[model samples]
Target: MKNKHLFLFILLFVGLVFILSTTYTVLAEKDRRYYENTGEVVWEIDTKEKVVALTFDDGPHPKHTGEILDLLAKYNAKATFFVVGENIEKAPDILLRQYNEGHDIANHTYTHPIKTTIPKLEAELKKTNDLIYSITGHYPELFRPVEGQYTDEMIESVVKQGYKVVMWSWHLDTEDWKDPGVHRIVKTVLKGTEPGNVILFHDGGSNRSQTVKALEKILPELQKQGYKFVTITELLYMNNENEK
Candidate 1:
């Protein structure tokens, strides 16, 4: 009886170990794919060159959108803007300017709601996607969840509906909402930029003058540093072609 009890205990110990191992593997994978839930593209890019994709979120605001475009034009750089749907609808002309000036406009959802399991996420996404298509004549393949908030279902739904999840590799939290000074914004980006890095800047909601000012300095500085700014699609396309 003693021997049998010892064998049973050993079997239980082995079973516990196996369960723990499997659990770890599952958690790691879930973490790996968590960014996908944000309704953005999380694919890898080629790092062969000193190239980066500069992306902006939450705008097309009349106040700052035009200024942001002017700077990009001055530098002859293209960027991707994840725009809120309601904002786009209110300012179709700004959307036109973005398209006309040679930038890709992406969806950031209609209401820009926080990404919890809200009943409105699906509708919000659809509304924004539709609004963008209505004005630009094309739907952006990429998206960024409002405030970078998301759940697993949010990622799955966007993918199922045909969109790539986009996130930044370098974020100094411009806190553009708080209007951090232009010097701090420019310094943060210059100090943090790296090859194949995606930098986040903003161009909407409240005063984004600091963001506008920061770019005036950083765009030219980054050019001198030998970085080429490309829209997300162009960057991805270049990398894909190289791989082939």
Candidate 2:
């Protein structure tokens, strides 16, 4: 009787473990699939072309933004700048220069708010859109949520405002926001980048000297690899073409 009871307890424990493991795996897989789908928020493009989109956020910084622009010019590379509305207000000419330089200017919200109501989020996006339009005479068709933090309601709001939500490839995040050393930033980006990647960087936040240094190394290396830098719109267009 004792042996039978022990055997039954062990069997039940094993069964419970299997059930829990299976449930965890299924949930994880579902989350992965949800993020990978390109119908709405695009993470990366599907293509054979050696092209990548270099995107800067929280920008129009008084100094860093210009430095980044100069670097892009040096390489004759184009990029997409997701500018904050308040920053644009401070430096309208910089935003205008970004437009004049032929780089894509997109909306990153009027203010960088992490948590807010759907109505507030919508207003933020609209304000930014109007601001950019006021300067460039064109409203941005692309919107990247502040900090890539978005709830379904936030996404729906942006979509209703007639913008495509953009996200970067997970592996391509340089973590430059942390102000990690320049070498690390360069290594992280160059090592993780592949064809059709959307590489993320920042141009507006606290001292971006390290980011600038990393770019010095990153651009030449990537160009040497034959990877052409294009704006996010071009990358998306390439993706759409490949799908067809």
Candidate 3:
């Protein structure tokens, strides 16, 4: 009777161990699958406000940045500029102007390398943050990676540096980077805009005259439609308030 009891106890213990191990494996796999599907990156915010964010990347250009700034001022609109460190170094005055104009300036990496290792990304972010602080007396609270390319490691690195990653909605690409004429750029933005959308434009890395022209048209039209242009920070803040 004692031998039978011992055999039964061992069998039960083995079955329990197997069940626990299988359960762990299944949960682990489920978590991995969830991360795989849901980890792409934030593209937009869902809100009912008739407000949108206008964000310009790769800028602080001598001519284009100034032009965009003037246009924003004309319309009494605000924007965020994701500036490259190297460009800021070359045009600190432009960056200073952006800050002085009450526009949000964010990091877009130091050299704008497409794909980078962890160490390199850290270096890029640190260098850019340092430069921005030197000019604006504050480190950037926001960051947008080069070309909107993000990885798990990259996101981790950015978060470690105390930045909120920002992407856009309603791209409004304009292909302005391609110098695709002023009319095309204007049409694209006017057509693509919607309430709570974030529009993307470039004010650097090539001639951006078309972008300037498009903005002249896009800004007034959006304003006429009762749309308010806010910075990314403001947009997020509004969403938070609504959630609460």
Candidate 4:
């Protein structure tokens, strides 16, 4: 009777271990699947095709936005601009010019907050989307967090809002906010650019003399490299089509 009771106890212990192990595996598998389907927290699409996306952040600055648009037009390239909501309201003409010029305008958030808290993040994003739609008569399919700051919940919330989170694969750091020289901006972007790269730049906020200057050189140089610039939406669509 003692031996039978001991065996029964041993069986119970093994059964409990098996149940726990199975439960863990099931949960882990579900998490993995969720991440696979929804964890695309990227600023740029990753592909090997000889296409580059030039995405400017915090833009529609008065003088610089026009200069950049002219440069893009000269090169016959269509890049993406992640514009701020307040800036859009301030410079609706610049936003209209961006849309009219065939550049893809994306949301960079309403107030350009650091996204440290959930409520602030949601507010920033929603307000930006609303402003963009109000000005452009269209909804943006892409969004970039201010300073690329985000939490997992923030990312999930953005995805739920139906905007793909865009983060740069390359950092040219035009540092245009500091009014760096045009040559400095040009050299930084030219050196860092690669096929399928998403180059980060800026057009708004402060004196963007450097960005304006850099574009004059950067545009011609990129064209010479046979790099075709496309908008974020075009690139993402191309990527999705290629997957099939």
Candidate 5:
């Protein structure tokens, strides 16, 4: 009797271990699958297509936005600009120019608030979407949160509004919002350059003179390496002509 009880306890222990391990694997796999597909959010695409996305945030600045646009035009490069709604009102012409030139005009927010409640978050998104629609005929499909700060509920709200939460590549962030030296900004890009990277820059929210200066080195050097600068959307769906 004693031997039988011990055998039964051992079998039950093994069964419990199996159940727990299986559950964890399934949960981990679900998470990995969620991130791999562009379901409702994106940090960076997983590919080796020699196509890098240049995304500018907090933009539509009068001077800096114009300078970045000019540089993009000269290089025959395209980029995505995450514009704030209040800044759009200030420089609607710059916003219009972004649209006319075939760049992506995504919503950053109306006021660029961080870590706010869900209701306030929705309001910010709606006001920005309305203003962007007023300026441009199309509603932006992409919305980037300020500093990429968002809760799961916030993401759910955004998804219901038909917007994708966009984040930048951790490897490619230059911290240029601090006005880091132009050389550091350029070096960060040079070191972290990879296929399917989303390089982050800003045209508003602070002095972006260093960002402007770094681009002079970045745009040309990346182009020389045979990597095409594309908008974030293009990077997401790009698979046709991937360069090895």
Candidate 6:
């Protein structure tokens, strides 16, 4: 009888531990933003190829977007732009140039809401996708949440819209949205970059002259290091190839 009682205790102890861990996991994952892990979401590609995905967020900024495009052209590099929907309405021509020049134009939600319900989030994503399709006549396959904030439900809603949710490399966020000095932005990117890195910068929602200036140095320097700048889709293609 004592042996049977001990066995029951062990089973109960294991079940309690599992319940505790699951509760912890749910708490830890809710409304958090950072790197990607163990899901359909992609944060950084896994590859040895000396290629980087340079992604700009909250953009289609009239002046800065054009300047960034010019700098990208100067280096013969490609990038992905995650454009907000309202900004797309304001700067349709800049977005047109982004598509015309063979860059990746991705959805960044309609209102850039960081805290929202699942239905609201779905509405925002669908609206942005519709706007993109209207302009480009092709739906974008990639999306990034506003401020990179999401819960599991939010992710599910985004994926249901048929987008691959993309976040930036944890180390490669240049934080140019804060108007960090041009030198600092340039240094962060140059020093933190690695193969398959997705570096983040912003061209809207703030003064982006620093970002524009930082790229003047970053693109040429990275080019010197034999890194080919690619769109997010191109980087993912390399990752898929590497798996085979």
Tell me the whole-model lDDT of each prediction, alpha carbons only: 0.77, 0.85, 0.80, 0.77, 0.84, 0.85
Residue-level error in angstroms, candidate 3, position 177: 0.7
Model 4 over residues 1-244: C-alpha lDDT tens digits? Answer: 9999999999999999986643422322334335435645554555777688888988778788888888898889999999988888889999988998888989888877753577777788778877878878989888887766555676678888887877776365456667767777788788887766778888888877777777888888888888899998888787678667
Off by over 4 Å in 2: 1-38
> Looking at model 6, how many pairs of residues clash?
0
Lowest lDDT 10-residue stretch of candidate 5: 24-33
lDDT of 3 by residue, 1-244 (tens): 9999999999999999986643422322333334323532344566776787888989879888999999999999999999999899889999999999889999998898977788988888889889999988988989887766566666667776777777666355556788888888888788878777878899988788888988988889999988999988887777668668
**Over the stretch 132-207, how does candidate 5's per-residue lDDT look in tens digits?**
8988888999988787665566667888888877877767878899877999999999889898888889999888
Pairs with steric clashes in candidate 4:
42-167, 43-166, 43-167
lDDT of 3 at 212: 91
TM-score of each: 0.81, 0.85, 0.82, 0.80, 0.83, 0.85
lDDT of 6: 0.85
Off by over 4 Å in 3: 1-41
After superposition, the stretches of candidate 6 with alpha carbons farther than 4 Å from their true spots are 1-39
Descending-lDDT candidate ranking: 6, 2, 5, 3, 4, 1
lDDT score, candidate 1: 0.77
Root-mean-square deviation of Cα positions for candidate 2 versus the true structure, in angstroms = 6.7
TM-score of model 4 relative to the true fold? Answer: 0.80
Better model by TM-score: candidate 1 vs candidate 6: 6
